[model samples]
Target: MAVDPRGADLARLISEDPGGPVVMLNLLRFAPDGAAAYQEYSRRAAEFLHKYGGRVLYGGQGSTALVAETGQAWDAVLVVWYPSRDAFSSMVADPGYLEITSLRTQALSEAVLQATVPWPGFGES
Candidate 1:
């Protein structure tokens, strides 16, 4: 699911609890002020996420490759891991998160938050 800055359509998506493993990704585009603000928000939000079994698997302003079948380019990436879809939903429902959402919407030029089901080939070694 993609939530734009407007955040007008999150009501239905946030209400459902699918109860399976979930990954929440925050894709950060280049904006010095926005990046700084999001980092601060992320630090605080991480604390709250842990209470409900949300583990931040990886987060950084690091290089990553995005090959688009539709032919596009993406810059930096941030990823968080949640125990289950229910846990993911709970994180968003938290009162503190509501406040943070306002800040995130402003900081991020565009944000794509999606629910993913791991492929069978995922995590192969």
Candidate 2:
């Protein structure tokens, strides 16, 4: 499973900009002994996120699913909010941030990263 985004994927993410903040939904499946590595990645990533006007809205280990497909269970879930799509793009493109990406790659056996849009009448805006 590929954890790192490709150049084309980044390009597409930027091109499809809806012009506002974006919440990234991350579903991660950790490799053996990967949790500790991911924790280190998170610690370092927090700084870059702050620099880019982003933050982790929520993060937690996955639990037993009440409802889901056979292969839909994830080991962890994270929701990161960026001030804008461009902010997220810039963060990922930063040289310093790029150097730390290997930690995330090494920590995950599989991952899903998706940009989420807020809907009307949702929980907090």
Candidate 3:
């Protein structure tokens, strides 16, 4: 089987950044036993991300606020920012972050990752 290292990649990418925004579209499958663990891990992750100057601008459950229609009631949503792409890359290379990978994987049944970049619009904030 092909081993997916995305969890590690995302964690490290956000953990070492000096400050910027990274938005995560969390699609956590509902599992009562895993909710607390997932949240705990996310909190710790936020701490690490902040150390890199990253900030989670907002995080909440999706309702009519999201663009896409999803059947699952995702546990939560997360948005974070890192200094730059290079800073994000640096975090991905850090070996120390490998330890937290399982915690994230264990707490969720599914997750989707997407990369977003800003687009300038006329008279639009």
Candidate 4:
């Protein structure tokens, strides 16, 4: 499976920008012995994330799923919040960041990166 985003993917991500902050939800399925590599990637990625005003909101290994389709279990989950879609784009486009992304690519067998939008009345009447 393709682990890296393509030009079209970036374009779509930019076009879908709703303005303001964006929280990215990542669902990852690791390759054999991939956790270590991913850890390295995460460590290196922190600098770039911070440079772009992004931070990890949550990150954890996946556990038992009470409800899910077959073959839908993920190995890990991460939620990263960015100041804006542009910030995310900039980070990914950075030359240094791109150089280190191979670690992330090699570590994941499959992954889902989704940008989440906050609902205005999500928690209030």
The worst-scoring run of ten residues by lDDT in candidate 4 lies at: 116-125
Sorted by lDDT (best first), the order is: 4, 2, 1, 3
Identify the runs in model 3 with alpha carbons over 4 angstroms from their true place: 1-24, 30-32, 64-73, 122-125
TM-score of each: 0.72, 0.95, 0.64, 0.95
Alpha-carbon runs more than 4 Å astray in model 1? 1-19, 30-32, 62-72
What C-alpha lDDT values do all the predictions have?
A: 0.65, 0.93, 0.57, 0.94
Evaluate model 2: give its lDDT: 0.93
lDDT of 1 by residue, 1-125 (tens): 23352233345445554556777776666444787777777777877788888877776664445656542334456677888766766777788877777556656665666666677788868
Model 3 pairs whose backbones collide: 12-91, 19-53, 19-82, 19-83, 20-81, 20-82, 21-81, 21-82, 22-80, 22-81
Report the Cα RMSD per candidate.
3.8, 1.2, 5.5, 1.5
Residues 2-95, candidate 4: write the lDDT tens digits. 8788889989999988899999999999999999999999999999999999999999999998899999999999999999999999999999
**Could you give me the TM-score of model 2 versus the true structure?**
0.95
Candidate 3 per-residue C-alpha lDDT over 11-121 given as tens digits, one digit per residue, 9 for 90 to 100: 765565545444434445534476777777776666567655666667776556455555645666766566675555555455654466566777766665444555459
Backbone collision tally, model 4: 0
Total clashes in model 1, counting residue pairs 3 or more apart in sequence or in different chains? 0
Write model 2 residue lDDT over 1-125, tens digit each, in one string.
78888989989998998888999999999989999999999999999999999988899999998899998899999999999989998999999999999999999999999998888799775
Q: What residue pairs clash in candidate 2, if any at all? A: none
